[model samples]
Target: MHTPDPHRHTPVPPVRPTRRAAALALAAATAAVGLVVAAQGGAGAAVQGSLAADTQFYKDPTSQVVKWVAANPGDSRTQVISKRIASQPQGIWFSNYRPDSVTSDVRAVTSAAAQAGQVPVLVAYAIPNRDCGGASAGGAPDLPSYDAWVGKFAAGLGSSRTVVVLEPDSIALTTCLSAQQQNDRFASLARAVTTIHAANPNAKVYLDGGHSTWNSAAEQANRLRGAGVLNADGFFTNVSNFNTTANESSFARNVLNALGNPGNLHAVIDTSRNGNGPAGSAWCDPSGRRIGNYPTAATNDSAVDAFLWIKPPGEADGCAAAAGTFVPDIAYQLAQNAPDPSTPSQPPSSQPPTSQPPTSQPPTSQPPAGNAACSIAYRANSWAGGFTADVTVKNTGSAAISGWTLGWTFPGDQKVTSAWNARVTQSGAAVTATDLGYNGTLAAGASTAFGLQATYGSNNTTPTAFTLNGTACTTS
Candidate 1:
């Protein structure tokens, strides 16, 4: 997730944390002009190598995945991003940021990502009055023209790889605009989603959800509803910003709960650079933030949809370089040496870090004795192109898990290339598993994790079901 420091610019006071108005205008223009807009949708090459490497580890065929891989090579965390994208069958992204005069060329970009076996991560920001000249600046001029531009923008979608992140900061940062302006922005966004879906139904669209520190669940839900969250596939949170996965997940769940209809809504998180979490709510180019859990598809709760890299990390947010400019040197340094927040500290903690989402809170009233029920969520942290699985297991159950086992079946006939964090051995149709030094002897209502690094020939399937001590988890 990417955001500029509000305090840095005096003109743009940090008023209630709002969306970049330019995104709204961009949607309007795209609607009118059609997707033949311009070529301003792609990212600069600041952190292209690492970002690309992260996406290629899974050996996905998505154009964006391939773009990232083709851009970067010989790095260590390459496999991590690759595995994350490969875990899921599909995803949606925005196009690179280009001007409105040239062709939208959505098909060309989508084809590239599709060929890579992944989806393009598109960012729709060519709106008017974008960013209000704040941290995330630059956008189309006004609403009337924006509508025309969006029309061109929509026309660019190809049949292959594509996942559209429609106008990030468009909703969460609406506080800067008046009610009429807000309404206009929502109407424009609704139009963008409609146009894109109409252009290509396969193209998944996710609206931006403000970071964890920004909005309360109810506030964001109302904002989302006003912005037509129901009309879109799902909403996105933590784009080009900083927040831990655990914190973002919990926050998203809370927002979904406020919405009251999990069936109609899904949420995605930007896990690009949140490994070490945020630094005291600062949004500027702050030091010490490491990459968070790479983008993955493991769903701890049923409501949240997928984790994505909407905000390509290392792409300077105007501070490091031009906003949205992808600087490879800065990106490489970030990937290679981001600050680790979890490391044993020699000083006091600045921000309050929450433990993994509470596994299982004791029931106010116990269920029937024979039906003592508890749920556990498993997050597969490591999985890359070749083959590997290093999963962290959280025993969100009530009873102490004396002995535990985690297992999954691949999509094709893929086999584990290697194993780590736990003991893993494959049988005929099943793979037996055990905890590792890092994840074992999970106390009642505690959490632990383990994984295996494996290699795949040409046929490796995503694990269908995972069992903890023979108990199958609810994976939808």
Candidate 2:
């Protein structure tokens, strides 16, 4: 028997940063964002609930909360949230570029998951101009550099089946870029899919589709298609936001339908920090949002692959704390306040509506447009990501117009995808939905109706102003 080395048995001093030893532990864990691969939610003292035999995953002990709970018993938040949310499956954000360790980390996580009969979920968010130079900026300097980084990132997946949530906001948030920049970004994303698949055939890659409250289904579908959805597994929604599962599921289905992918591409929704919905418009670590459903691949929906905790509940979303930093109290609140999925909600869309009448200084209600005075109404059945609208035009004037045309601009990149009951055409956000054969003419004091579908990027506000044949219509 060999004697112990002088350094092998050295005593280490503990660093107690206030009552929350969990905070200290959270500060030191690897894998950014919510790294996936595991059991239901957080596990307490003895790790309750039985594994789903062949349905569930995420057993490798790699969570920050796991370490915090084990290291800090005094911190009750560690046991509270960690038992249910943190100890479960989550996604890993390979945000930093440590090429040397990237391979090992990927192999370690995937290999462990595979050994335990689980599939690991990973996030590759190192695209150039990531987050549009916002709080989480500084991705690869350019496309070539990003490609090289993708190579290293994909190199980590070692044959075992893995689910990869690729590039959050890369597609849904492309309004920041110009036409040429968009082409380049899409090319880079396409390159990422090819690269990941070439490296690991077992890897299922998915591009990001903002959220239900953000992009419209059709617009997001086109964006997803442009970014090469065919090459990858599918697209994901609500990566780090608080949109509800019902809204996300409906929005994602609409997206997949619009894309018309032959292979019925699937989708995944992040059920993290969406319990109590958003606290105001506070997306960055809002106060009251609670943890959502536990991670599960057995999502009954045919189009949905899994309901995952993509963004770990406790981690701050670049606002409340230091961006990705974790706060124990926040974690505890999320866990404690998590809404019971078993309990049916009063309303399906639990989150507060973010849409408002977003328009330019147009005519108010019942404003006069031309000699044929007109009043237009803009109403869209909107969810987080997309919406369909019905516009009713009434000729307040006594003249009966032979034909009519309506024009409007979306507050954001809200583009019309399809139109019916009118001849609709959209260039950028400017829409021109001219009347069809029967509804073209408006008799004196007569009103006609036309409906259209459009998709938006972020803000799904109802168009504030409406123009009838070039004159602004009044809201009143």
Candidate 3:
């Protein structure tokens, strides 16, 4: 008789982390709005309020952001970053082809989630020619090695529910491969899916279906079919891409329809950084983007399986830093720029408001006596004709500032289109940003942040001069 696996039957203790009660309330409030999902195992519902406090998806304690937070306790951005970006559940990427360690590595994460009675999102990215020789390259040397590696990967599921995002860009970006090579790749993907399902029937494996803006739905469906999508649970879209959730949802539904809407097939979308939508077709670390909806299985759409953060926010897309490396500044910017969760719901606007110069002038407050009153830190990410900037206003004075207005003049022809955390208005190259009541007060040595999205014609230079309440401020 075969001995049963020892790791399979570990008893899961009751999960009652302190944040669970509060998360339940937030989840209930947003359930009607399609922001929260029911918890796995039917124990209770979960929301994305605190670090996997109430979500079915497990929050990996060893995630890059978590390590960053622990390493930099005194960083000014730590509090917000900890509460927002670091607290969320993100995909744990298994990108290497280390067959010897792959099973144990996978088991560690899955077993942790199992003990917590939560599901884990895992990305299988070790396919040959990964990323089409782009920034994220390297994988198993050949198809046979990859096939064996995938079998070991599947063996680590350990009798619990899990979500696996298999080989992003595999089906969608196979243009460079020859006819026979493409056929071989598809065969490998199909075999991997079979192995995963056979290993753990509780595992839901999703194949790659590129974003809405990439291939047409019919074309993607055909490719997914060729890669054995019918045998898989469904396909996933927008992995690591910045496409809006609404657009992705529609695109996924269209793809399902094209795939004959098999009852067993569905779609999951990567809503990691599509809150502000795409910056045209520019995919590599574009600016002005925000974190989208928190990961949830209750998308309220029958055709869609779940909305996932397949790409962890703040990890560079090979531009800002090496690909997959987490940058703290980007993480802070994304969390700070996210929409206010407590704001009342409003009708979705189809178009951005027309850009026009400010009609009213900034408040005329007398200048403070010295340059020590305030200082500013400005950082920006630019691509082609557009960019986004994050500005931090530090109170370098001894007294509290009850209200504040920040003014600056662009050295170039940059035009502000929209803003967040403050009210921004532009006239010619001059811009004024006033506190929006909530963030006006800054105690001695305290700081606050705001951001803006803008466009430029030929140049995009940082503004050197700034003023807070009409007092000149130093720049960094």
Candidate 4:
């Protein structure tokens, strides 16, 4: 979600889009390290204060939602959707250059937040070779240019309580760089942390820790150390991904411990889009993911400073729309589907799950290929042209299915427009829904659910026949 501009550096050259397979491989590799290799926050005055009222308004006038709301006020979802998008806090990204105006631009936002008794949360994303020169690539042309830019960035924080999420994917994706490149980056990051606090002694800077599933605690901690995290206020996890708070909190503890548990080092978790955890390993704009914890400094855990909205909802993560472009429809779906923060859901694993033999669970008396019995059921609520539906899948067989797909034909022209908790693809009159990593493996005689929303012209009839994988599911 957070990437640097490749054009600016020129030398780094834009890298290819990250394939899901490659990401999963890295995640698996690092995940194993956290479990087997052994395991492993801070308080500062500048970090003091509640998250400034993020009213997602004014920060980006040209944002997609702004245009959608003004033009479609009569649309039934306008008020709720618009308010949801505008009400939450979004990180103010400092991606573009203009050293002359950078200081003033940042100052204006910080000053406004301070005047309103709120803290300004800024994202200093102008790092060299950010996002491995992918999606959101754009940074200062060179090292000196970056330093000057960060200098101007810190200059804008005029003594107000501030939380800076330094760079996203900057540390986690360093594997894409050469050895020299890595050292230079780490050095610059270290300087950036020092430079920021030097300019505004009241600012608390947080370095990136990738995400719980992305990097091994020891690996990330080593990087944090080399990058001068000891000089920083703390580090943050899950900046742009959807790993849950429980998992992130545990992961943060591990990283801190790996870093020698320095006193007063606190970590922040990005609660922006982790509502449903992750829909499998699908990272870029996967459907079914929802908003998670609201911005709060009251994490109760001393090691965690707050659950922040480092990544704003509605912004496409490259695939759904354009990376960083806020899409009103996607934003509205996430808000509408968000779970009640008060109600406790399935708790995330306290420790990372270790790989085990496939037969950990007792095997069925008679297991056979394609012999899993599966069934699906659907329920929906609709208004106007928009509707949301939840589909439930059940397995009644002697064998468990490692992965499954459900397909059906819409009775009418009703078409799925967006979905979550699963991967959805539609063609003509038929729709195919596939499992995300989280819900892919269904045990025999067990059930799981996924949801989607669709638009209709004159009809919105539910599809009657559903199949699991290729076999038909009997309707209850």
* Per-residue lDDT of 157 in model 1: 68
Residue range 1-476, candidate 1, lDDT tens digits: 23421111011111111112111110110000000011111223211211222232112233233345456666565544333322222222222234343133444445555555654555566555555556555556677666766777677666643556777777888657888988998888878788888878776677767766566667788888887778887787887665655556667777878788657567766655555454433455555454444443333334554455545444456666555444454444445543222221121122222212122431222112221122444333222324333355666667665555666665555555333334567765467766432234566667654444444556555665776665666543
TM-score of each: 0.54, 0.63, 0.64, 0.64
Q: Please identify which of the two predictions, 2 or 4, would achieve the higher TM-score against the true structure.
A: 4
Q: Per-residue lDDT tens digits of candidate 2, residues 1-476?
A: 00000000011112111101101111111111121112222222321112121344453354555556678788756666766555665565666555565666566666666776767677666677777776666567888888888888788788877778787778987767999999999988999999999999878888887776566677788888888988888888887776556657777787888888446378877766554333323466656556655566544456766666666667655556665555677788777744333332222232222211113332223313466578987777775655767678898877887677788888877877544446678887788876644456778899866565566678786777878877878865
lDDT of 3 by residue, 175-287 (tens): 77998999899999999999999999889898989866566678889989999999998988877776556657777888999999888888877766666555534567766
What is residue 356's positional error in candidate 2, in angstroms? 23
Ranking by TM-score: 3, 4, 2, 1
List lDDT for all candidates, in order: 0.49, 0.61, 0.68, 0.63
Comparing 1 with 3 on lDDT, the higher-scoring candidate is 3
Identify the candidate with maximal lDDT.
3
Clashing pairs in 3: 46-54
Model 3 score (lDDT):
0.68
lDDT of 2: 0.61
Off by over 4 Å in 1: 1-104, 327-329, 337-476
lDDT score at residue 371, model 2, on the 0-100 scale: 63
Question: What are the per-model numbers of colliding residue pairs?
Answer: 117, 34, 1, 18
Lowest summed lDDT window (length 10), candidate 1: 28-37
Cα lDDT, model 3, residue 328: 85
